[model samples]
Target: MKKIEVFVEKANDGTYWGSTQNLPGGVSSYGNSFDELKQNLKAAFKDYLEVGRKLNENWVQEIEQLTEFEYQLDIASFFKLLPIKISAIAEKTGINPSLMRQYASGKANVSEKRAREIEKAIHELGEDLLSVSF
Candidate 1:
């Protein structure tokens, strides 16, 4: 059960694009939305695997056996894909709302420390939501 990490980005035309980070020749795809992008990326990769299989590429065959994909995207890409409000998340994470907005828009670089803070806050929020009975 191998997972290929797909790096995703939001294009200028509001399209989402993604590519495998560990695959050669760059298995990639684009879509109007995130779900569509993931679907297309897998379909494209399967086709590529079939072609590779015919060529007897051992590496491709190994990956083809059970290669799953997981998307890794930046903050800007997350905002583009989800309805999450930046200011709200920022307040919960103790980040300045304006600074968080800049991060979400790719206008600012988030340090590793800040990234971890945001990730931790999101996970905690998810857990809190999961505990709701109503």
Candidate 2:
């Protein structure tokens, strides 16, 4: 199986857009936040894997090569490590609950703006928690 590493970046419009560096012209959803982007990427990756499986082609190796020497981070796990709930994040960011849910479940696309909001909320919550602990 060849692996394909996907890279996501935020656009000026506050959308999280992603493309597989291993697969040229392979771009996925443009979400309103980072969480949405992660969700969209999950869906896109699943589809890509399924299609590859159906064709008896494995791109896992390719992806590994593409991502080699690059810092790899699991966005979902990072979200899970947050001290706050998705609901809180949504409330703080004014993002739709449904959208946050989708991102959590890997079923929806998150925009760059949303991602920033989530990050900000998580950071703030972490700081607050630290202050309490001290």
The TM-score values for the models, in the order shown, are 0.88, 0.41
Worst 10 residues of 1 by lDDT: 61-70
Candidate 2 structure quality by residue, lDDT tens digits, 12-130: 46566666665644636657766776677767766765676677676544542442222122344355433447788778768787787778655776677767777787678778778
Tell me the deviation in Å of residue 69 in model 2.
14
On lDDT, the candidate that comes out on top is 1
CA lDDT of every candidate = 0.86, 0.61
TM-score (C-alpha) between model 1 and the true structure: 0.88
RMSD of 2: 11.7
Error of 1 at 44 (Å): 0.6
lDDT of 1 at 107: 96
Residue by residue across 12-51, what tens digits does model 1's lDDT show? 8989999888877779999888999989998999888888
Per-candidate Cα RMSD to the true structure, in Å, reads: 1.8, 11.7
Tell me the lDDT of model 1 at 53: 84
Tell me the lDDT of candidate 1: 0.86
